[model samples]
Target: MSLLQRLIARPPPPRTAARVAVATELPGGDEVDVLWVRDPRARRLRLLVSERGARLTVPLRASQREAQQFLDVNLPWLAAQLARRAARDVRPAFGRGDPGPLPLRGQLRPLEWREARLLRIEERDGSIVIQAPPAASDAMVRRALRDFYIAQARRDVGRWLPAYMPGLPRAPRSVRFRPLSSLWGSLSPSDAVSLDLALVLGPPAAFEYVLVHELCHLIHPNHSRAFWREVELRCPQWRALRAWFRGDGLALKAEMKRLVGP
Candidate 1:
């Protein structure tokens, strides 16, 4: 290996001093402030951009020069992403007692709130009615609401998974759902499939499409051409659904975070 690379890879001696903060100038002349972190478990440098800001994590004892170089290379791409996020209109986050229609099942369903002895979420007359005590805490309401969303997501998975099982070599070891920041679905090395629970709030077709896509992974674990062909054969509308996500994925995730995430 090259001497510089070897120097960056080696662990620092005990009692080494912490490095200064890393910041770089964006093309528009604003400074992109980075939260630099050294992680012992990290295998390579990773950049995370979120509502909070940018975070750069590097392998323990990696040289600041290497980290800075990495950040420099990724700056343009980061700038573009930040620009997209900045340009999109910002929607206010959902909060308790807002009584606004919710983004549900590809439609904005009217949401009605009422006082009851206990918290409950029910669907009726093409809308959702939620009941809670006269003084329910926001945390309590959010928790109950998140549970409701999870149950709904599972119902869709239960309905669609059986149909896709026929031609596949075997069923997944397990199927699970949860909130994922950046992925719609993932297949673990153990063949378990986990999907983002937020999908239940979108169109049913998108939910079913994601289910089929993950089930296809039981046969081909990687995204080789053969794998995509299998996907197309199973779900003919896969491409359109993919395009749908490209257009609406960010908003959907943002909605999920607002409604259910802590």
Candidate 2:
């Protein structure tokens, strides 16, 4: 084919729309940025709020004016959600001269910074003490804090996993921890289990319930009656735990994210 014909036959690149964001003020005078997103798959206008801010998604068929009206109508709802977050937004600003009362293993512990030969953390007398160099940066402190939390979480899992192991079909190939946005715990197809690190910031009972729940998945992968029965066999108080999580889990996740940064 001629070069011109070949050029003509080539399909055009997909159109990409630039992201749009607008600022809106709350009733209490707090200004928030709302990102306007256009999605073809969205059937109607939707507003999503988080500690970061708000996002307004619009269907392809909707106009910007319609979207703005929808946002105005939902501003009150957003305000209420933000208020709830404010109550839970208690994680301290680290690295500053200010000491903290950070959440740890289901309770709030006072945070203290001290100068020591090594940059490390130690919990004693119901307080979290970080011994850092006189000139250590905030990022260094945050890393030490993150590592401290992970180590503590691993300690909990180690203590609890063996209890659930003998009854399971087999041991998990592996287990991992991270900041999961939507799930408390998950069992991979290979029988590996992954859990949210924020569980360490909640009640120990809730954390163990998640471990028990995932370990049972090795024998029954689906949430059928049999799986629930197995879960009950391992975790008798799971019903109460579920109710507690429904009330506090998401807020715990947001709190953890804020503490650790992103």
Supply candidate 2's per-residue lDDT for 19.
44
Candidate 2 displacement at residue 100 in angstroms: 1.2
Which one is best on lDDT?
Answer: 2
lDDT of 1 by residue, 1-262 (tens): 6533443566546534223345668767878777666666565787766545567777774686888789889888677656766664375556578777876789888999998999998778988888989888887887888888887788778888788889899889988888777678999989899998889889999988888888888888767788889999988999999878755766677678778664
State the lDDT of candidate 2 residue by residue for 1-262, as single tens digits.
6432232233223343234577888777888787776655566787776545677876666766687789898888777777777776775546645557888988999988787888998788999988888877877777777788889999999998887778877899988888886578999888878999889999999999999989888888877789999999988999999978756776788877766655
Question: What are the models' TM-scores?
Answer: 0.70, 0.68
Q: Give residue 255's lDDT in candidate 2 (0 to 100).
A: 78
